[model samples]
Target chain A: MIRHSLREALLSLWRNRFMNLVASFTIAVSLLVLGLFLLLAHNLRSVVAAVGSQVTVSVYLRGDATEEQRDRLMDSLRGRAEIEGTEYLSPQAALEKFQRLFPTMREVAGELEENPLPASVEIRIAEGHRDPDSLRQLAEEMKRLPGVDDADFDLPWVTRLRDMVAMARAAGVSLGGVVGLAAILTIASVIRMTIYARQQEIEIMRLVGATRTYIAAPFLLESSLLGILGGVLSLGALYAIHRHLAASQGGLVPVLRDLLTTSFLPRSTSTLLLLLGLAAGALGGLLSLRKISL
Target chain B: MVELYHVNKDYGRGNHALVDVNMAIEKGDFVFLTGASGAGKTTLLRLLFREEIATSGKILVDGMNVSTLSAFRVPTLRRRLGIVFQDFKLLSRRTVFENVAMVMEVTGVPRRQQRVKTYTVLEMLGLNHRVRSYPLELSGGEQQRVAIARALVNEPALLLADEPTGNLDPNLSWDIMTLFKTINIRGTTVLVATHDKDLITRMGKKVLTLDCGRLITH
Candidate 1:
């Protein structure tokens, strides 16, 4: 019976193409606003993920530390929280790594009689626990160890990037919430006006003995359909924005080294858009139902 | 069956719509409720349909106390009754077929069954050819016929017509009154509220006259 009512409602909407178009237009505009924020939220997450993965906090060893003390320091660093992987690089290994990175630096090393570099324990923090404050605390704690002279984060750019990403995430969530609420209100009012215009028809149906559910089904279905269409339109708009961003500001997204880096909308975000559209439509229908009678 | 016992309807501010109206209508009986303008004829119909509650009296239709009927269950009571409006209240946007089929649709009739029943009713009214036509495109008589078709499609146990012929010419008015007669003959109780003296007198049937909200005769 409910399904039949839905079919009837959709049929009624289809019959009034102009009215349906007006309704769809309202829904589409709301969805565009919603999708824009969703894209921001999604990109913020990706940016955070990229920067977090690249963050590595390295601990420098004391210049005169004994091999045993260095090994102990390595064990202690390994046991610490947020430590990804640790490598105890001997002064020669450090030199070799430096030489490998800059072949021209080998001549400078060759000119010096004594190796000036210190043997260091390089620590990488796990992506999940890579918070700036937490990493800074961990580094300080490691430096306090008897064999460790100082702690150095290999990636100096991570501090600013982490802060920027955090700010972006906060802003994105805030914008997303505001835009989502606006979308709901927009759809609700549109549906409300539509229901108001048809109040007479509804009253007639009520007088003619139509059930509340019978009258509500069509409106609910229409709302849902509107939401779905809005969702699709939002997704399309979001995608277009993403493509334009990637073209105009391709390098804005960090870690562009890997070709896998993309500003595309996430699968979850797209699914959310679809669900949001449907939910908006359903909610709009309910809102209109509450205000109008059968 | 319908019965109104000492029904007094007051709309606040000392305005009385129906004053102690007492009347009784038997099952499958036909009746004309005659009165001039503002004589409580429409109000009487509204009371029977449970559209308005009598302030102080017992009103029962088909053994259900309408005066005490809750708003929620009003639709159920209405389902057993068919109402014809003066304006022919057909949804002008819908085709004649859809307009008539809506009643059966409300009753949860399947599409196929509704189609068959609607076609049968339209055929009976000799409107089978105009089934696909919109109500606005139809003449006044045809529109009235469509309204009648909608009211009768559900096979309601009770039928209420409120000034059904107000907009019709004499011939069309007679035709509509005859349509009501044919429906009443099919074992459906019919109550027509109209000021058409000639049409009412010619049909005879039981007459319930209202004078300024008071039941003058039954």
Candidate 2:
């Protein structure tokens, strides 16, 4: 019975070509826009995490501060709980690291006959406490410590990047939600029209002893197929667009490359797109059930 | 194999379609229901087929209560009966063979057997060469024959037809009657609703006449 119904549904899809095309167009467009938004959101989130993880505070110690004072500062930093972890970089390690960054400056550093770099406590703050206000408060508290000479961070730029990421997320969700609903309505309307065209056939089927389940099965099958097909088309389009952008080699390319190593949709995200497309189609079919059985 | 006891059908505003209608049809009997327009011939047939429930009554066809049948079971009851309409109601998009073989499809008959049985039935109805023709391409008489073929393809125990010849010419109508006679001879109970008094008298079958939703004679 299911086989026959499936055959009938496939036939219906072919017979109602124009209506099916209309439905597929709407679904594809809707899913494509939603996919693009999610893809951008994924990249944005990666950037935010990358920036968030880079926030580290180095507290420079005074040249004359006692060992007890250093111990007291280290213990206070550990007890604050805002710190993820800390590493003590002595004057020698700091000089070596600076030389590693600028290899040509090694002779200049040796000519000084003394390490000019300060012995500092490098603090990796917890992700949640890395906001501008909290970091400022932490830096102020650190400057008052007995062994601390200075505490500083690039707060202006980091604060701007965080605010921008939050705004982009809100905008993506709002725009994607509105368009997705419109696409679902389009699918439902198209299915409704196709079913209406076959009203006479359904009535005749009933007269010939067809159960209601048999009569309604074909419509459901057709709608679900349309949905999944639309999803595939959307994914294909997104891939093509991503490829185009990747090939351009413009100012955006380096930043995009730095943030995202692969194309827009990762394996997991593409799977989610497929499942979402299927759900939209199923929901549209369900909405039109009462009309078809009429 | 059908029984109706005190069946009444009301169509809102106190318009009764069938009132206190009691009747019985024995197995293998040929029965005719006659009345003028709006006298409830269609409604009575509708009730027997479970298309509509009676306001107050009991209807048993083939040992199942029609009035109490669930929505899904309506198809099961219909599977054991054949019904033809004046409009033919044949699917215009499908070929004669597809339309005729659809009953077997509903019963889950294998594909090979469906073809064989459909071919045999169409050939018996003198529609062998027209098997590939669509319903719109066939003549009125031929269309009516295809409808009959579809109804009988399942070899049901009973057949109910509402004005099966109302759209055909006089000669075609007589031919259809002969076809029904041959079916009745093969031991299937047949019930037809029509108002052609001349044809009714000539056939001399069991006639049930209705007047104003009331059964006047049997």
Candidate 3:
């Protein structure tokens, strides 16, 4: 029965190649749009994670601070419950770190008469205390220390980044849902047309006592094949677009290079997309069959 | 074997397709249902196969009550019987072999068995040489024979044909009747519905006549 149904589905697809191709292309375009949003959401999530993990408050010391005041500040920072850890950098060490980070500025630093960079202590916040309010309170308290010149953290920027990630995710989900529904409807209409064309054959089959399942199996399989084909086509198009953007050297490529470093969809996600395609096709086939009394 | 008791089929709005039609055919009997157009000959045959359930009656075919048969069980009942039509109802896209083999395929017959059974039936119907030809490529008589082969490939217990020769010439129609007679001789009960009184008189079989949805003679 499976072999027979498979043959029937393949034959039907071939006979109505033009219409099936149109349907498949429509599905492909829909999936492609959804895939693009998913890719954007994935990259945003990665950015949020990377930025959040590196969040810290930096406290610069006064140039004229005494050794005793510096020691006292270090002790106070260590005693704070919200502080995960702290690393102190001397004036010369800070200069060296700055040069390493900004290689193009190394020559300018070498021409300086003396080290002008500030000595600072970097404070890593504990996971539970990393919220904007808590970090602001910690920074304000540090700024009141005797040897601390200023204490600052990019809490607002991090918070904004998180919001952007959330928005991207929500938009991706909503758009994907709408596009997926459209794809299913397209497939259903295509199958309906095919059923109409083969009405005579179907009537003959019914007259000869073909079971409902036997008659419907080939159509169900055909829809699923269309969905799977569309999925593969979308994946191919996505990969091609990704390759083009990754290889381009001008325009927004350089500006967005940091975010574009993100990899393609993971294997698990790609597999899930394929399954979604199959489910949508199957659902469309079922919807088309509802009105048919076979 | 078939039996109809008080068979009543009513199309809504004062249209009664069959009225209190009571009849019976013993096992292995060959019978003809003769009537003018719209006289319920097709309706009676359809009722036997549960295509249109009788408004109020009991239909028994091969010991199964078809009048009360559930929707899902209709296919099971139909598998035990073969039905041919005036138009032949052959799939134009499929070859003669596939058309005939389709019956066994629907009933879940094994592929190897389907091939053997399909070939044997075609050979029996004298259509062996036309197996590879499409329906449109065959003559009217050949197409009808292919339809008959499809109906008989499964070796049904009963065969019901509705105006099977309506589109064929007199010679071709006679040939089809002879084919049915041969099938009857091989022990398959046959019930044919037709309006050709001349063919009926020539065949000399038990005849059941219908007039205005009422069985008038037997």
Candidate 4:
């Protein structure tokens, strides 16, 4: 029975090749839109993770503070659990680092009578304490220490970046949902048209004592084939677009270049996308079958 | 083996298609249903196959109540019977071989059996040479022969034909009736509906005649 149905389905598809192609292409375009949004969300998540790993706070000591006061401040900071580790740069060492960073200004630094760069300690925040509120509280505590002149961190910038990533993900989900629905509906209408074209065949099948399942099997198989074809087509289009963007990063702006460096969807995600296509196609076929008396 | 008791079919608004029609045919009997157009001949055949349920009476085909058969069981009842129509109803896109094999395929016959059975039936109808031809590529008589091959492929217990030869010429119609008789001789009960008076007179078989939804002769 299955073999017979499959043969019938293949014959129908070949007979209506042009209409089926149009339907598949429409599904592919809709899936492509959804895939593009997913790619954007995926890349943004990578950016957030990269930025989060580098989160740190820098504390500058008062120039007139005694060595004993600075030592006590260091000891207190080291005792805190939120401080992962700290690197201390003396006044002379800070000046040397500044010269290395700004090579053109090295001559001006050399002409100075004394080192003017402040002695600072770079504090790495622990993974568990990386949230905005925790980091802000830690910075406030550091600023009140006796030998600390100021505590600085890009708190607002990191917070805003996180917010933007969240918003991008939300938008991707919404757009994908809407576009996926449209793709399913398109497939359903296409199947409906195929059913209409084969109405005579269906009536004959009925007269020959074909059960409902026997009559429906071929149509269901046709819909599923269309969906799977659409999925493969969209995946190929997505890969080509990703490859083009990745290969032409040199001409892109700094932000876009960074985004281009991110990898494509992972294996599990790609498989999930294909499954989505299969489900949409099956659902579309079922929706069209509802109208048939069989 | 078919029986109808007070079967009434109405198309609503005082338009009666079959009215209180009652008849019986024993197993292996060959009978013809004769009437002019709109004489309820077609309606009587339709009721026997459950294509259109009777508005009010009982229909028994091979001891199964067709009048009250559930939708889910209609296929089962039909599988025991063969039905043919005026239009031939052959799938034009399929080859002659495929058209005959379709009946067995739907009933879950194996591939090897389907091929063998389909070929044997085509040979019986003298259509084996045209197995590869499409429906439109064949003559009207040939197409009707293919339709008969399809109906008989399953070896049904009863054969019901509604104007099966309506689209053919007089000679073709006689040939088709001869084919039906040959099939009936094989012990399958046959019931045919037609308005061909001369053909009916020549065949000289048991016939049930109707006039305006009422059975006038039996």
Lowest-scoring 10 consecutive residues by lDDT in candidate 2 chain A?
A255-264
Candidate 4 lDDT, A83-195, residue by residue in tens:
88888999988998999999999999999998987899888887778887887787788899888899888667766877777776677567766877877788888888888
The model with the greater lDDT, 3 or 4, is 3
Model 3 DockQ reads: 0.69
> Model 3 — TM-score against the truth?
0.84
Tens digits of per-residue lDDT, candidate 2, A92-115, equal: 999999999999988899899778
Off by over 4 Å in 1: A1-26, A33-37, A40-44, A77-82, A95-116, A132-137, A140-144, A152-201, A244-261, B5-8, B20-22, B53-58, B65-72, B126-139
lDDT-best of 1 and 2: 2
Worst 10 residues of 3 chain A by lDDT: A253-262
* Model 1 per-residue lDDT tens digits across residues B28-98: 89999999999999988998888777889999998888888887789888888889999988887889999
Residue-level lDDT of model 2, residues B53-165, one tens digit each, is 99999999999899999997999999999999999999998999999898888778899999998999898889999999999999999999999999999888999999999
Residue A262, model 1: Cα distance from true site in angstroms: 1.9
iRMS of candidate 4, Å: 0.8
- Candidate 2: list runs displaced more than 4 Å: A57-65, A68-85, A90-119, A125-170, A249-262
- What TM-score does the predicted chain A of each candidate obtain versus native chain A? 0.77, 0.77, 0.75, 0.81
Ranking by DockQ: 3, 4, 2, 1
- Model 4 error, position B202 (Å): 3.2
Please state the error at residue B54 of candidate 4 in Å. 3.9
